[model samples]
Target: MTAIEIRNLSKSFGAVRAVDDVSFTVEAGTVTGYLGPNGAGKTTTLRSLLGLVTPDSGEALVNGRRYASLDHPLNEVGAVLEATSFHPGRTARDHLRIMTTAAGLPASRPDEALDQVGLADAARKRVGGFSLGMRQRLALAGALLGQPKIFILDEPANGLDPAGIQWLRGFLRHLAHDTGAAVLVSSHVLAEVEQTVDNVVIIAKGRLVRQGTLAELTGNGGGAVRVKTKDDFAPALRAAGAEVEEVEPGLLRVKGLDAEEIGRLALDQRVLLTEVTHERSDLQSVFLELTAEGERA
Candidate 1:
């Protein structure tokens, strides 16, 4: 079942349209990246889903129902939209305990949530003394207090160091893979999101520009073949209906064919190839291209 759905959702701020006819879905047991350039209406869309902002038209649904209409909202959806707002003097454990109680979860939930986010060791530390990464973990712990089936996070890796980011990636993957949870994470870090999410929804000017699995989105233009030949083979490669460009001396980037085809063509032409590697478009390049196109439109 789809965990999150947005259909023709739009929101306007006076004369400006922050989001326009955005539509997408995030399925269960998957981690979907929600991405866009600044002012692309990503946060506004998320707010609409959470009932923090009312959409001017259309609807945003969670598990087929409006977020505010859910019987047990916290138990059904866990969200960390921004940094955790904690009392400076409050201990991490106390902060989580308060949320656990408010959410109607058991007292033991605070510790479990802390352990889930690897913040157990800092349970007694005052939040004011905690690092930015630790505070992020605390916010995540609060979200997990009810063990929600769906998670919505915005810029989750903002304050995380390299190690924390890696840990978060693994934790999010485990949530979707092992626990059958649905995760929608929004971030500007396309490279990290590419590595972490199963699928992506990219927006620009508040409208969806692309939505698909990583492979489906980046699989266009077939694949590029990087060939290292003993001699210049650009002319021969171009003759074989491939677009060839010399990346470096003796290294040619060939498009419009697979590596095997490139190898066969080179062999047939008596060009000895030292290396032939297939290359796929990374998320960063694809994202930049889509957003840039949207701006030009």
Candidate 2:
């Protein structure tokens, strides 16, 4: 079943259309990435889903019902939309207790949640004294306090270091695998999402550009093809029906053609070959191609 369903969701502010005809579903036991550049309406769309902003038209349903109809919102739909939305003087533990208490969850869960996010050592520290990463972890702990069935995190990696990003990725993956919670993580970092997400919904200029499994969006992802040759056989490689493009100065990325075929073709053309590989598109290139191609058309 879909954990979250957005049906023809659209939102507008005056003459500006923030979200336009966008629709996608997040499934149980999976991480679905919500991707778009800044001002691409990702945050606006997410806010509408959580009832923070009423959409101009269309519907957003969490766990098969509107968010407003839910009895305990925190238990049903947990969110970390803003990392710093806490009282500066409050300790992390106090901040979380207040939040979970408002949602009717046991205030005790706050300490456990903070521990889960690796903040147990700093629980007594005032929130204002926390670093950006600490505050982000606190925000995540707040979102996890009720153990909700689904999570909606807008830029969860914001202010996080590389280690923190990696930690969050693994944490989200475990949440889906261990607890069977659906996760909707929004980010502009395609490379990071490519490492963690199972499905992706890409938006550009308030419109859907691509939505599918990472493999499907990246063209069957059968490992990757890497080709290296010192031979000036670009024309010959092209004529042989190998999908090739310049990666750096001398490297050409080839898809759909294997190393063996490339070597044989170069050999037949009397071209010296240094290397051959099948490593195809990286997530960044795949994302760039998808987004750029959409804009070009």
Candidate 3:
């Protein structure tokens, strides 16, 4: 099930094109990581989807309808954008209580959400005294007040400690894999994302650069072989119909052939390889490769 869809979405602020013809979908029962560098139109695309910003062209749909057109928006989508703020004097429970009341949700929802986000112990603490990580959890608790099926979170892991981050990883996965919700998390933390996300939507310079499952983006299902050789094996590898890239002066990233095959071919061609290792591309490497300025479309 497609929970969120952005079709040909483009938005401009004066002369700056914040988003340009970017499109992607988030499926139900999966966590999609929306990743990009600073000022890469990630937030703009998300804002457009939440109806916080109107697009110049294209569509941002929630369950096949515009967000504003939904009869009960809060019951369908829960968003925790970067600019989330709370009254300094309000207790965590109070803040959530206010939200539940405003959204016509049950009063018990505040406590339930606080417990869900692990903020039950601090429910009575004023927002001003909470640490950044605690505040982040509080904000998340507010978003959970409606118990919506779709979550749109921006930089959700910011300010979290190592343990908190680890907990968040499991929390998100449980939400999607266990309960069958759809989650879209936008963040620049690549390592954490590599572990937490099922799918990835990457953008660069206001353009959709890549979108696929974690395995597809990372090339983990059938990884390439990285060969370091003093002699030239590029010609032989190419001749054998292998896609070879000289990633460095003497280092080659060879696809379409396994390490054993490459080693045999290298020996037959009299190429002395110093290294022949299968390389599983990580999210950070692939992200940098796709979003690098020189490689942009």
Name the top TM-score candidate: 1
lDDT of 3 by residue, 1-297 (tens): 579999999999999999999999998999999999888998999999999899999999999999888877778898887634888898989988887877899889999999998999999988888888898888788778888899988888898899998988998898899988899999876887779999999888899888899988887534689999988789999999899999999999999999899988988988899998888767798888878842357
Preferred candidate (TM-score higher): 1 or 3: 1
What is candidate 2's CA lDDT for residue 64? 88
> Estimated TM-score per prediction?
0.88, 0.84, 0.85
On TM-score, the stronger of 1 and 2 is: 1
- Ranking the candidates on lDDT from highest down gives 1, 3, 2
Please report, as a residue range, the 10-residue window in candidate 2 with the lowest summed lDDT: 219-228
Residue lDDT tens for model 2, 1-297: 689999998999999888999999999999999987788889998999999999888899998888988888888888998787888999999998888778888768988998999999999999989988999999999888888989999999999999999999999999988899999999988876778899999887778888999878775444446666666777887888767787765688876577788778877999876776655566677666666665564
What C-alpha root-mean-square deviation, in Å, does candidate 3 show against the real structure?
4.2
Residue-level lDDT tens digits of model 1 in 157-243: 889999999999998999998999999999877866778899999998888898999888887524788899878788877888999
lDDT of 2: 0.85
Query: Which residue pairs overlap in candidate 3's backbone?
Result: none
The runs of at least 3 residues in candidate 3 whose Cα sits more than 4 Å from the true structure, single-residue gaps closed, are 220-277, 293-296
Model 1 regions more than 4 Å off: 221-223, 228-233, 248-250, 256-277
